[model samples]
Target chain A: MNLDELYQTVILDHAQRPRNYGELPQATAFAEGNNPSCGDEVTVYVKLDANGEKIEDIKFKGAGCAISQASTSLMTVKLKGKTVAEASKFEKTFHDMMTAVTLPEYPQGFGDLQILEGVRKFPQRVKCATLGWNALKQALGGNSSHDPVTSENE
Target chain B: MINAEQLRNDFPILHQQVNGRPLVYLDNAATTQKPLSVIETLDHYYRKDNSNVHRGLHELSNRATEAYEHARRRTAQFINAASADEIVFTRGTTEGINLVANSWAFDNLKPGDEILLTEVEHHSNLVPWQLLAQRKGLKLRFVPALANGESLDLAALDSLLAPPVKLFAFVHISNTLGLINDAKQFCALAKSRGITTLIDAAQSSGHRPLDVRDLDCDFLVFSGHKMAGPTGIGILYGRAELLEKMSPWHGGGEMIAAANYESSTYKPAPHKFEAGTPNIADAIGLGAAMDYLDKIGRDNIAKHDMELAAYAYEKLSQLDFLRILGPKTNRAGLITFVMDGVHAHDVVEIANTYGVALRGGHHCNQPLMKKLGTPASARASFYLYNTKTEVDRLAEVLHKIKEYFTR
Candidate 1:
């Protein structure tokens, strides 16, 4: 019922000064995702290791609500150095953490992506949390030149 | 011209505080909130006259039927159609268009026959025809927008007009662009070519005065909720003879005259199309809504909305980097725009911070969005209850947004 609770300090910190806040100029793998329902959009640029399996660098740039931008900030930080396989697994793990009847056990040693647990109370912003992860899967899927296309996950 | 400040008092929702500020709702294009009268009508219907119609001889059912049928007659006369029998109630404008495209276009259109539509049609209008064209093997032709220097060619419409042009299904006022088609010019042209025109009056009916008999448009459709009426009810008007010719869109109890094993004769026109139990309460509510509009005067309401739209367009256009993406002429009661370097979602969120409610995004018009080369826009539309002050507040929000983002 509290709007203040929805915009907690953790969410605002990531929103005001997002972690991976700029474009990677040398990003060979890129994908742009847009929420057709609300017009929230984010384009992710990922510099992959030469094999295009592990993320070397990742960043996002777009305009949206505070929740959306911060969620993207949190998502990208979770994505760096993650293998394509691990990035895909993190997609399911992130969703479980956000909207479960019971919270999924957070994996140890993973950093600030856990902050997105705030989004579980606000179900509407799940699109914001997943926007970056969707782009990562597309980039690593070897269709890096293509804009992010809708899949079963989208 | 209507006392907009006084008019705002009747809407309970508009008077409320949002984020410690007055709720300046300008999102009529998306959904207009319920007026007190409309809300009361809903409560009254359920509390008193709740029953099935036409079959029950009981007092409640009888009154409910009378109110429901009264709405049918009002909807018919609101558009100046010949009679109530011609009005077919559907779920909304999307279903209404699909019914026309499938039952009429699919049946009548053959290969090489052209179905003409404007470039700015809502996806509801555009998509049904797209699917119909594909399925029926008919040529779906578009009257692409007249872009300055983008096309030195004559309006493709004039050249596209041919004898085999079977139908002209286009919006009376475009949902996104707010372009009010000159019914005389466009309808006259389509009539001359023997094109059976279906005007999507979804935008025009409440915002402007429309006369189907006067416009000479063969088919017209408008949704209820757009005009301060209840949702889940829409009007589809077809010429009486044409209604006689076209088959029913759905079939069930009320639509049928008699049913045996494998053989059934359907009831005439409107009833035949209206399958199952109708939105009886909302139908009555639409009648109340029309009565409310008539009390204010439709012509006066129309003029008032146009005045607000023109004012909003002028003031909003003058702001730095604010672009109104619609007709420059006297438009319908809305201005779809985008501020420079600020996305529409951000604009909506920032505007919400200022207690201004508006619509953002492509507004269900993907083809038009692609034509304009933008993903989405922020729309501050007006209605009878909207004011120049709200427009001024909108301009202030954009000014503050430019400050918020750039400075």
Candidate 2:
């Protein structure tokens, strides 16, 4: 319930002045992700390596809440050098951590996504927190129609 | 004057607190709170008359049929439609727009034909036209808003109504801006050019007194949730002739007079448009909502909302960071603004912390927000039961929220 769990310094730093918060020059993969419930949005880009195994670069360009953008910013940091397979796992972990969906790939340090766990409690902002990861999964060939409008988290 | 204390008693849910403060629900633009009359109507239907409406033989089904037909009649009266047959029960205004776009516009629109819309149109109004135009190879035209944001440029609209312009779409009031556009004058002008018109009354129906006959629109759409009714039901008022001419959007049971393998004929007007079993309970509930509104006298509700909105506008304008969007020349019950150096969501979160339930986002009008040169906005929408005291709490909490974020 305390802001401590939700606003860890790292998430705050990324959210306050987000890094790589713009579109890229030769975007590898692009997908539109939305939180239709709250109207939050995020477009994730990951320039994958030759094998599409590792992320060479990542960026986002869209308007979203702190949790969403911060989560995207954090994923952009944590996802570097991670294979598409690894990202699928990280995504599973992050998804489970955020939505309690119990997916196989859900990651640890949900506390890393902690600023957003307040989202799980609020139920409304879960979309805001997960917009980025959902977008990331879409770019990594998980699924294409990543519309958050009908997403259960929203 | 609205009976604040007495009126507040009917809404059992509004009395609760949020975060740590008394709930100040100013999101009527998004959805209005249901009154006990409407709630009771839903309960009464489910408890007693829960059956498939229309063409039923059993007593329960017959009662349901009567109540459902009675709601159609009541809604017809609510909008002053020529007949109950002209009123179609839809899911909400969004569904209504999609219905019209698919049913009417699909048949009528052609390549190079332009559908004219205004800047203040909501996504429900704007997106359907966009889809129709995209699907039919039609061009979408828009009349730009003036600097003050009070209304669209009538002269520009006149110019835009050239031969290619087949339909004109717009909102009676901007949900984000609170500008009540001059619908009669505008729609009349569009009609002179032989243009069909659709008005998104989602924001206006509950906030303003409406006379669809007087407005003379080919179609008018409003949601039940935004007008003290259940969420799943909305009313789409179309001229009987227009309704007769249009095809059905969704094809299913209950909309046809007869169904056989070789060939099937559809029913006329409202029945044709309403294809499934329909939201019978919600439709009955909507009837109850209209009855509640009639008892209230919409003029009185409009006046109450207008006064509170004006007062909220003035109070919020006193702060430099708080800038209300759109025209201030007197609107129905919406006030959108930005807090300096703060994101709208942040402001919304802080306000949530204080138990003030205002809305924050593009409010389903991202293009309008872009026109206003803002990413998103915070909106505090007023409704029937809301009072000046709640407005004061909104103002106080907004300041406290700004401080919370800035500090």
Docking class of 2: acceptable
- Quality of model 2 by C-alpha lDDT: 0.80
DockQ each candidate and list the results.
0.32, 0.27
User: What would the TM-scores of all predictions be?
Assistant: 0.88, 0.85
Tell me, by TM-score, which candidate is best: 1
| Predicted candidate 1 versus true structure: per-residue lDDT over B1-407, tens digit per residue | 58888888878888788877899988887666767898899899999999998889999999999989988999888888899998888877888999898777777789888888877788889888888888888887778775411221226677776767899888778777777777656778888878899989888777767789888988888888998889998889989988887877787889999988998998988888888999898888888888888888888888998899899878986886977787786788888987776667668767887789988878898666657767678888889888888899989878887776544
Q: What is the lDDT for B13 in model 2?
A: 86
TM, chain A, every candidate: 0.81, 0.80
Pairs clashing in candidate 1? none
List pairs with backbone clashes in candidate 2: A6-A115, A92-A105, A92-A106, A93-A105, A93-A106, A93-A107, B26-B381
- Give the C-alpha miss distance for residue B221 in model 2, angstroms: 1.4
Query: After superposing candidate 2, which stretches have Cα over 4 Å from the reference?
Result: A1-4, A8-14, A17-64, A68-123, A126-154, B148-150
